[model samples]
Target: MPKSLQGLTVLVTRPAHQASRFQQLLAAEGAHAVLFPVVEICPPDDLAALTAQLVDIATYDTALFISANAVDYGLKALATPQILHHLTLGAIGKKTAQALQQHGFTAQWVPTAGFTSEDWLALPQTQQLAGRRILIFRGAGGRELLADTLRQRGATVTQVDVYQRVCPKIAVSQLKQHHEQQQLDIIAVTSSEGILNLVAMLDNPAWIKTLSLLVGSPRMRETARQAGFDGTLIMADNPSDEAMLQALIQWAQE
Candidate 1:
């Protein structure tokens, strides 16, 4: 028989627009999907700073995007294709690079091994950033290590938050009802912030004991552990849809 996740209800906590593929994958293996979209992405409230920074885009030696959302929002704000031809582009992960490529911009640098800030810092291109001006488009409040490390390496890094990620206020009631009914099985968290938000939503330890936890990386797995997730924690090798499905398949087999 096909590997079965029968009767297992997996909670996907990614943004709603991004959860469909993962939900379908789980459903194909007999798992019920509980969509508790804990995070929502919105363009930054104030765009003036971003606009001011972009005015000098041609002056920067490199521009970096840390996430696909950053690429999406950043491109949307630019509203024209001319800005891309002015500078070299760097992406922290394959997904981010792919996003840029889809928008017809190529990434000159991408992390080959791990897709974290530390991994980005270790890349050979980062060694000599002296006098180079780099623009980083990202969500609010994240990956400080990359920017800080770049500064220490002698690069002038200007980071602009093109988007914001906040817990979805609308999902509170649904999440509570699902927990009370014991309908949640596995909780899939792609970031450390998501994990913390999930924990905050639970409100009580009893509610947390009912679900398995799936994470997207070793760093996130460690974060889940630190946050007191006693349930099984399975890590997706990468954040791609295929890697996430493979993780689900492995979990079902065990």
Candidate 2:
């Protein structure tokens, strides 16, 4: 509301559906928010297989969601959402937990401090698992850290892919046009895959490497570095839209 980001141009690389709130946040501060969606969220290829798994949903001791998309799509795959009430529901972040709440399910465990798998695994409740049946609902090709660690703790972790992320086809000239006009200030990406897609979308990304880069997590920042982005890397405390906006405002003030 203070116009803290006045005159700034921010390149938002989140999926189109998730970019609107962040765009509004930037616009509220008088910053020019550019929409350049790098990732597209879609249903998994085998919806039948995903739906079939829900038949035995009551067999699992616990159900964990990796993201809000997982919560939405995963629940939709179920024939009877009420069947999930018996399981110990867990969410990786507050947002994911909130998503479950919207559908009348309460998450018994959600990390108060961090959103990563390591943070969730650090909980004493997760570490003491032995012969626990854990079901993970997530997008395709996500990190295996959570499931792998739970398996090590003697839990039978079954991961189900509810959604898949693919890079959308967009013209490189769109970003190039902005860069050429010297209108680009900062580029914000939330995921490792998004950052990679951003780079791949550009025909020549050398100029992007010089602009300020804001990322949601350390993993995303590291991915940017790996992709040859040597810009000023700004890490958000979390991937939430609010946290990302706060990080952007803080960087602008600095």
Best by lDDT: 2
lDDT by residue (tens digit), candidate 1, 8-112: 888788898899988888888888888887788998888886777677677788899999999999998775646777788899888899999998999988988
Clash number for every model?
A: 0, 0
Off by over 4 Å in 2: none
Highest TM-score: give the candidate number: 2
Candidate 1, poorest ten consecutive residues by summed lDDT: 201-210
Q: Over 4 Å off in model 1, which ranges?
A: none
* C-alpha RMSD (angstroms) for model 2: 1.4
Question: Residue 85 lDDT in model 1?
Answer: 71
